[model samples]
Target: MAYNAGMTEIQPSRQVDLAIIGGGAAGVLTAINALRAAAPGQRIALFEPASAVAQGIAYATPWPEHLLNVPAGKMSGFPEQPGDFLDHLLARREAPEATLAEQYVPRLDYADYLQQRLAEAAAASAGTLQVVHDAVVSLQPQSGGHRFQQAEGANWQATQVVLACGNSMRPLPLPAGNALPPGKVVDAWDYDGVRMLAGDQDLAIIGTGLSMADCVVSLLAAGHRGRIHVLSRHALLPLPHAHGGTADFDPQPLLQLPLRARMRQLREHVRIAQAQGLPWQAVMDRIRPLGQALWRSLEEADQRRFLRHVVRYWDVHRHRIAESVHDQLMAVERSGQLQRHRARLDAVLVQDANLQVHGRGTPPFNVGALINATGVETRALGLRNPLLQQLLAEGHARPGPHGLGLDADPDSGQLHDAHGAPQPGLWLVGSLRIGTLWESLAIPELRVQAQQAARAAIA
Candidate 1:
């Protein structure tokens, strides 16, 4: 690896047993698991560009209103130790009550928990675990291992590389030839920037997913009295988790069915559960464990059909909000402070200091600001990350099924080259494997993937 001319003095090339990219939850967990599985003195380097590790875009929020969608009991960093997170909370006196398992804590709290866990893992590794604060820009296959080049021209060689670069926010789907006006539009995750807007400024939020819900909670918490408009193809918000807790149901029988039949079974299950005085969420919870397996069982065409027709509905039901947050959203809706529209955004134009948002089958509307909460871009080819772009361009990796993310082995997470051959020593975890495993995003699935990736890399 060569450094750019006239750049600052480059550091000497470092060697490591494993190199994990991106310091989000996935990366941190992979490092911890790798450290635990590695032999004594095995070097592990985690490359994260941010000043802090494990606080990825999701957990980096400072607002207490941004809470985890999952309950505390299920948010353990280690799958083998299911109560680790709860134990940490108890030890820190953050939530001293033993009954705090069902509590939905702030996302920042989870970030802190993950950071602490990373620190503990580092200490236990006895200087073998190193957190390199730099962005990896490119990767190349070398004679004995892989060479990773950083943004500042530093390079490192590792016998194995785990691509745990999580998710990236999708760019606003603005119409052709229309550029988003600066200062008038913000990413929904920009909590501080969104809160800085005047309370009376009318805001239009694109997409009614979890991020949109978070924005609503943040705006309400900030005492915003603006007329908030939410626009999506189907203006459906996420349902709240059952207050009575999840119920028992069997998803095994439905696993072999096709997409349509499987969905019918799910609907019938929900109906029966509701008639039997159980919340519909119970059925979803039962199916959670089998989500990825069922997804993989589908034919490629059926999988694509599911993505086109069933994904939105599944997401709204599967990923729910906290009951308190749901109540707040309902209160705002009942007070006429919030409005939901079912229309696809077509264009965004700057009309003076305001934004003119055009939608299909609706007249253009003006808003003081627009927030893009359309969620992460799943199509791997469209990502802007230099490393991913280079990897795909050079045939180091290919797009996963349905173009959702990088293509990798479902069991081992070993990356597949453009020609569909598994690339040895190259693994992918977290949301990057969403194409291979439909339920790869959340902690429950990620922890398992982290462990598997570490073991595979070490093997």
Candidate 2:
């Protein structure tokens, strides 16, 4: 449980076969897979400052109400072992009644499954796998390998390094030149702080995404009776999963078309499916497998166009909410306790000890608190992570396309330098591959990326 602060300053330096820079699901899976594929005595080092591995921000929540967007059946940590997650849940007897394959379980349960898998992998690997509870601040290339410097003054050299650093928080989108009052704006993740607010205090949330949904859920669960104002450019909410199982559809035709044409085709297919008594979720589920290929086929202009015009709509459909959670949100909206506004935030000023929020095409409003649920920080070079900043400053890594993530070889997950040359022994997994693989965030895609990166790193 020792983090960067309490770690003994041994300045531990060792040469290992592989070094993974994160302990989230991606890093944990990569370590497990790499260790299984490595030579008998090969060593692996995993650096994570968190209290436990595999419980990244997404799964670290303790709330039972926060459920996984995807079903239990599709959340396996291993690409080859599709039933691993369900098996783990069954073995632990967690939620035996709702253990059906299509159930969207709590994210906390998923975190337990991941931790259990990581422990099992480590135990099976004997003494080859080592967990280092510290954050890596910089990665420097050396002869035949890379040297990593930890935040706690420890350094190590590895033949290969995997950057599984997941998404960072986006910068708060507050209006400029405004002297905000204390305790007015808070991060969506600060659940405790948010819970301390008065029940009848008016609140304004900055985004209309999953995080925003979670905030609303938390407030409602805490019996908050205040009016919750959700503001965004489009005010689009996530769609819910279908009641029954998902049906299959072919995405090959859509993949062959241009971005706009593909979108039109998808809309037509959804319309056809709805007319035939099938849910639109079924159609989107069919395209999940072809997401990466379809994204790669788009021209840069088309990609930008997709981001500008299609991202919000696509996100609402692609990343859905659990049926129960969706129902709760709907109930709140129906009760008039929740209000949605489609206006761009212009400024936030403090007036009479309350936050006065101004949005384009809308009248100014006052709120007791503001919450930022703007989602992940997509711009790579602007991230607050010291390691990434150091890598970019030292010319070891470059920003990915459209400022999505770090630049890496799409096929191999190998990190690239500022000169656009692929660096040996450096890899990226998970959301860091957002630019290369558009569908890299979720477990289904990340498991494949972890397997691919592990194979290349250990080869």
User: Candidate 2 residues 1-459, lDDT tens each?
Assistant: 212223323333377889999988899889878867877777888889987777877887787878888888888888788888888778766565355578888888877776676666656654377778889998899999998888998778999999999988886675566657668887887766666663998999899999998889888878899999999989998789886445556678776788878888888988988887888888887777888998998989999999899888899999999989999989988999898888998899777878888999678888999998998887887689999999999999988988889889998898999999999989999897787777789999889889999888887
TM-score of 2: 0.94
Candidate 1 lDDT score at position 358:
90
When superposed on Cα atoms, how far off is each prediction in RMSD? Answer: 4.1, 2.7
Model 2: ten consecutive residues of lowest lDDT: 1-10
TM of each candidate vs. truth? 0.95, 0.94
Clash count, predicted structure 2? 0
Model 1 quality (TM-score): 0.95
Number of backbone collisions per candidate: 0, 0
Give me the runs in candidate 1 sitting further than 4 Å from their true place.
Answer: 1-13, 94-98
Model 2 off-target regions past 4 Å? 1-13, 94-99, 244-248
In the range 1-459, model 1's lDDT, one tens digit per residue, is: 111112223233389889999888899889888877778777788888877888888988999989999889889989889999888788766654646888898998888888787666666664377677789999998877899898998878999999999888888877567887678888887879877764988999999999999999888888898899899989999899886556576678787888889888888998988988888888888778887888889888999998888889888998899999898889888999888888988888788888888999567888899998999888998788999999999999999988889999898888999998988899899888888888889999999999998878765
